[model samples]
Target: MEEKIHITDFLVIKNAELEIKQINVLIGPQANGKSVIAKLLYFFQGISTEFLKGIRSQLSKRELDKAIIDKFESYFPKYAWDGTGFSIVYTINDIQIEIHGQAKNKTKTKLSLKYSEELKKLYTAKKRIFLEKINDNQLEEEPLRGRGASEASIYRQHILVPLRTSKYSDFFSDPIFIPASRSFFANLQKNIFTFLSSNVDIDPFLTDFGSFYERAKALFKEDIFIRNSNDKQLIKNLYKAAEKVINGEYEYKDKQDWIISTKGKRTNLANASSGQQESLPMLIVLCVLPILKNPNLPKAQALTFIEEPEAHLFPSAQSLIVSIITELSSTFDLKFFITSHSPYILSALNNCILGSEVLGKNEKSTERFQQINNGSGAPLDFEKVSAYTIMDGKTINIIDSEYKMIGAEMLDEVSDHFQDVMNNLLNME
Candidate 1:
């Protein structure tokens, strides 16, 4: 979309539009539609990829238009698509993506995936499809027409992680998400242990991330057995990422029904401290991303969506998670969408942008700056990051990485007063 989303008559999105970014951080009070927006992006990205699965070997203007419209039915009728007073648009390449729906009697859903320059909708119809090539650019496009034919083929090779620990655990097989209630993952250790040590074909999304988590755990389980010379490098890389984040390597002890080894001590994943239970799997996943060079899956890219990775972590540890992701993203190809309420992470992200603005400069290399950025070895480029706040109906970018500054847009509204009160109490003058 235009890096901004506008909503009215929609849930909590009364009249707001947000700018989207590579490192999209959504922060706002509870029930303010932060998660809704994040999940929408996840869905849109999934459908877009699904819709683009078979490329038109022939990229003629008309050919491209026809091919895109043909898949329209694949994305319509989203589980939560029934609504009105809503409009979302984003332009990527030559295509403009738009979704419109309203709440009224027999509300209609209209989605526009229009080619801006051609002035032609993919499908045109009186009420159901957009099929005509129009001459005017000023005509506001309507949303999704009736529905395209449902094609099973359109849903293949798609990965969309929802914001639930168990629901999206399967995605963790590829290190995609780290949920807020990370500690809750322990309850699944028993099930996961069974899935790994047995020959069961279970649905991961059935109960949340199980498919992926079990499979990922199976890798660690296999690594212990397969220590083959061919795979040692990849194995080392995986654990190295783990060690970097946890300050200790990770190993699973088959004895006592799936225990994790950290710092030479063995403990059941369930028995690990709240911090360990919450942070361990997430840390391992972080470790898994950069080091996971040659995965068995055919997927070329990974999009990770973590909900409150700061859970149960100390301020320093939180920054470490941010830093490791930052370092790997600097080198490897990884996309992350995180939802958080932690200022530590917000400020750390701001510093990432700051470091980027003055990389290699004497000031940035100073010990103080380096310490502030201890989480990452590489300077973070804010241009690659987009921070937003949902306190308002719109998602607004707060960190102007280009200026090396953090805006008040995302700070706690009471933070200003808090600062003033603290300053007066301390008598800093």
Candidate 2:
């Protein structure tokens, strides 16, 4: 699949064609459909072999269709729909998979799978997903429901990390989400675990972070966080990044169940400072990526979505965290889709872009990179990074092919306004 996702009138998203890259950054004002776009990508990427195979077990095509619709409603919420519905299309290689969901009833959703002309000639059903209801599920070849093993396999290879703490583990393994409100993790565990453990048919978008935190914590046993890394320096870089985020270093003590040690002081996650709490889960998740799967190859791609990593952090730490992500992206072959509202984050990214350009000419970028990167590792590869800002109901790409930022007026204006305010105060003196 080409890393681009085309969304048409899905909820608040009127029409969007996002060309996602290895490091895609979405920076926009709140409630402008940024999260919606991320969630849509999550859902689409998650429509994998396991998901399709699960639907195949259903007795009727109607039941399968209903199941898919219900999943979408729960995953994305019906209220986001602006009554116009949505048409999402993904073109993988030459085969096309299109999903049309009407915001109204939602039950009126349609999914079509079209193959290339040459491939169409061989398949019994050129375009699977016949609107005609097949009476018997067993006899009706899966083409009736746009089912294909190869296509599912193609999608399943791509992973998505939506990073919404609430529904963290709904699709993936346990402990998927690490929340921004991690400081209150202790209280959250009590409430969220109760909800997750219950039989209630809650929405998938609704998650209990505490429950997922416990799950994520469980994955840390037996050097699993440091499993198969031949790169000692890379692992060191990861720790160095983690150390920069937290004011100090921390380790998970499995025996006490999430007890953390920092500067020889022992405390639970709740007792830790806000920055420590915020950075703890992120630090662990970053280290754990290499160990998430075994026999780790150099080419494996891991897609992770991180929401507002700057939460509870100072400006310096914010820049450090972004650089750490940059280092990890190159180290682990990770594809990060981050959503942020932090000016520090944007400025740090800007520094990275500039740093890459200067480094290409062999001029020393250490000072420039270190200042913007807040003392982190290698500069970010701007070519792999695509940044977009949502304004007036549109996600606009800020950088061009040469990594020149086009729409930075809003950030500049804010800084100018701050300077003007400072000058006004000085004038009184």
Candidate 3:
């Protein structure tokens, strides 16, 4: 199903599209609301009316009112409302899921979900169960609706499961609103798992080299004994992959432990490098493995958001990362939304365009390139790529060096103005 999510007034984003497979790279100076856009798209589900209702019930009347007012002032600077309320609307596969509310009082919010055929089925089944439980109690209406609300009375159990399942996990797992203090530790644990278990083949080496018995004989200097065990061979292969970027080879002694060989001696990963250097293995593992393991996930009709992927890597690595992104999009059914401040990453995308042109010289490939070069022919064509620059005001404007704005055809004046600014910046630096 094609999925499109539109968020309004939840944060810095006034309105924006969150869709999959197409890479939307947001670039601008600091405080231009780039991170705000990421937060809205990634946490759309968590900001729903149901979740907000629960939050309001936990806060004091004044605190709840204050929170609502603050979110409005921050998200919509030009507009102000005396009312305390927020809403999120999500459209997926022709179904509209809307959750909206306004503060009914300081301690309570009037919240409701706009039901669809899909949600209605789940809601009906749950409502029936809730009514059966309430009928068994035979309590007074006022007390049932008031402080004695049980779990079954307060929530529709079946409907609640749908809200908490994997389909809605992204809302809570979003890196932006989900507090970095807790997420940092969670992410670290996930990274460690990827580092140890990913992309290592063991069975082939074991069968070809006999097994543990052959290795024990080799230690006694016996002829025809296995030269290397399966564990050692796997470690050697891992080391070779690491050596492609780092200075030395890495060895995995056990499933949980790894050692790096520098010079002629072996050292634990922690002791092999300083604290700063030790962190690279984890970063590299996280950045590269996610794409490798689920290269086809983008094709699954879900949006994927990545923020500042160019952190803590050299220029060459950054270029390679962009190439990986380009290759994955072309080879799989995926859309990518990425944000970056690195000029090198942008230049790498530019090279993808140029490289495609150069490779189209052959008559057989020329027609294909022409189709992609012309936006009307293919949905994934290069023309579909757009770059937006966020201006000093909250407005985002599109700019391309190759095209002149309509009614601005004086090339000489435009060139002079650009050169003057470039000279001034250079002089200041």
Residue-level lDDT tens digits of model 2 in 154-184: 2333222221111222223222333345555
What digit string (tens of lDDT, one per residue) describes model 1 on residues 114-161?
434422332221111111212121243752332222122121222122
**Model 3: residue 308 alpha-carbon error in angstroms:** 0.9
List per-prediction Cα lDDT, in the order shown: 0.53, 0.59, 0.43
lDDT of the structure predicted as candidate 2: 0.59
- Measured with C-alpha atoms, the lDDT of residue 295 in candidate 3 is 27
Misplaced by over 4 Å in model 1 are: 1-9, 52-83, 104-178, 191-208, 219-248, 255-263, 291-302, 363-372, 407-415, 420-429
Cα TM-score per model: 0.63, 0.73, 0.48
Candidate 2 wrong stretches, greater than 4 Å: 49-52, 55-67, 91-95, 103-185, 190-227, 254-262, 293-302, 363-375, 400-407, 427-429
| Prediction 1 global C-alpha lDDT | 0.53
- Could you tell which candidate, 2 or 3, scores higher by TM-score? 2
